[model samples]
Target: MTRLTATAENQSLCTLSRDGSACSTAKYHEGAIAALAQARRALTAAEPGADPDDPIRAVRARWVGQAGAGTTGAAWRAYLEGGRDGLDILLAPAGTSTGPAAGTPPSATGPTAAGERAPGPASRVLVGSAAAGRLGGGRWPRRRVTATAVLTPALFAVLVAAGGGFPAAAPWTVLVALVAVAAAATLATYLPGPGKGRRPALGCSPCAAMAAMTVLAAAWFLQAAPHQPSMAAAALAAVGFGLLQRLTQTDASCAS
Candidate 1:
């Protein structure tokens, strides 16, 4: 590689628009990446109310940073003056500086070579929600909703089955109700949309399930005769409800 002349380095390094007439530069920076960063900063400042922290902004920052490296003075100046579209004119030249030299491990490659990028907030929330449906769990939080939905119906069924089964209503009716409730809860889980933080009770499956179960248990207690066995059963149900509710409200998505 030919060393950049002192005159060439000075012209490339100087980003001030007020600098002398534009000219081609052989050397832009000691590191190619650094040169692009300086150029991008100047261009970003020209935008109205631009925020550096914006996710897409951050992505573009990294992209222009590396892609701009080793750029000729003429290309850098054009990009600064005309924005991203201006870079199109210099793609062929910039493409050469990207990626790793031959024989470099994939991990050792720079962002340009690897072609991987972190998602912005909007994108992260969207992708996390989509992934939650197919995969078990991750950054997405749905443990509370899932738990309440599962535990309530489950406990109700166990208690009913333990007490010689439902006498007043056909066993199939009880089973059908459980299935319907479960289906509703499942639909609600995906319907109200994905959440980033703590979720509410209205649309959450586990929360709704727990509420329904508690009501069903209380009704059972009311119908039973005032005997020790009946009271003991109600007490057990109450205790389970409390414990399950507490568990459901926690970050239990990972347990799945």
Candidate 2:
């Protein structure tokens, strides 16, 4: 009877252990299913045509709200349909496997498995093409012209001062010309529609070169005139010429 009772107790313990293991497995499976279902629902609501299996769509869908539970359909749609590319979406970590859920405190060090750290928000790979495309290839060209426009007048001012011909009137005249040229250059760069053509008037290269020469000429003319004010006036003309030249060059480059 003692042996039989001991055997029965052992059987009961084994049964309990088996039941506990089954419950644990069932809970894990349920969690996975729930996560996957949530991901699918998010994709369907946001992008009508997006595949649930698509990693980009999946990540974007997950990002719509805190705890992966976006309130508005529009929010989900925007996230999924936004300019990010497929590769960007794919590189993000699984939403269920990482990050703080909505209303939950952010993970101190994110999801950890022993010593391995899951990718954090900053570490996730982005869709490069979407970002690149939005920036546009024309930015460099536009920036170059802008730099030239700003620098050319300053260069002329320095040259005039160094040449021992700093006329009082020159500063005001140069200021006015700078304002006008900057305005025109800005218009040429940003005004919509196809350009009006690559004609010299719009291109302004000759105008820029001429302006440089005019400044030097004006200085010489004032020196010859033997009048200090006249010299100042000549310096001013040089400044105007330089500004005009820059404007024209920018316009030309933009058109081309």
Clash count list over all predictions: 3, 9
The lDDT, on a scale of 0 to 1, for candidate 2 is 0.36
Q: How would you encode candidate 2's per-residue C-alpha lDDT over 1-256 as one tens digit per residue?
A: 1121232232222232322433222222222222333333344355544333464455445443332344233322222222122222233455524322232112111112223434333333222322222222223355446655775566445434544544446554454344334333433332221232333333323443454455555546544543344445555556555554443233222111
Residue pairs with colliding backbones in model 1 are: 145-206, 148-206, 149-206
The digit string of per-residue lDDT tens for model 1 on 1-256 reads 0122232432222342323322222212122222223234443454655442343344345545644557545434433322222122123232244443332222222223233333442343343333322232222335536654665676556545544455534543444344334433333333222433333423224454554455455435533632234443454555445434433322221110
Best by TM-score: 2
| lDDT at residue 88 of model 1 (Cα atoms) | 21
Which segments of model 2 are wrong by more than 4 Å? 1-157, 160-208, 218-227, 245-256
lDDT of 2 at 31: 26
What is the clash count of model 2? 9
